[model samples]
Target: MSADTADGDGSEEAVADEETAADDAAADTYTVAVDRDACDGVFACLVRDDRFREDDDGLAGFDPETADALERSEASVQATFTDDRLEDARAAAAACPFDAITVETQ
Candidate 1:
């Protein structure tokens, strides 16, 4: 029943290493959103995540009919996680078919 028991010091180190790597990966990542009023519903971010969605007004606006819908539409499509990817978000804004998406950051 207890045939395999060890100090497990190496396991802790391995977990720490994994956490460090994750932090590094996320360090450059942040959060992004669309202006909705400036979006044209081109859905270029559909490949990134299902969070992005086309506006109901037919102008690529960020529809907020439901919390889940809003979250999904804003999760990946019209949003990003690059701390220094404002340029990338700008490109998305420019790529909008209706020029209705606007990205902002701090």
Candidate 2:
């Protein structure tokens, strides 16, 4: 038996292209977390990852924790990222001498 494939609009290629685009748009997302308890304020994370930076008390990553304590303490600071910045975020996590940074991907 022969396969049956037909498109009245004759835009099969266009349909396939749209599907591919959708897949790309659904790329993985990531989040970064820093534990002030584990951080040493070495600034290694700031140097290694563009997403990280130095704050008043110490190094602060993007999308820091929402808790009011985050201003005084960095125990549970967090950051979110997409495919484009996932690598940078991970690098920052790895650069933490105290292993304060944590990268979570979905």
Top TM-score hit: 2
- Candidate 1: tens digits of C-alpha lDDT, residues 22-70: 7665435333456554555557754333334555554343334321223
Q: Candidate 1: minimum summed lDDT over ten consecutive residues — where?
A: 63-72
Clashing pairs in 2: none
Model 2, 31-84: lDDT tens digits are 677886777778788777765666677556453432212233336666555555
Prediction-by-prediction clash tally: 8, 0
Question: Would you list the C-alpha lDDT of every candidate in the order shown?
Answer: 0.49, 0.66
Off by over 4 Å in 2: 1-27, 63-74
The superposed Cα distance between candidate 2 and the true structure at residue 101, in angstroms, equals 0.5
Error of 1 at 65 (Å): 9.5
Candidate number achieving the greatest lDDT relative to the actual structure? 2
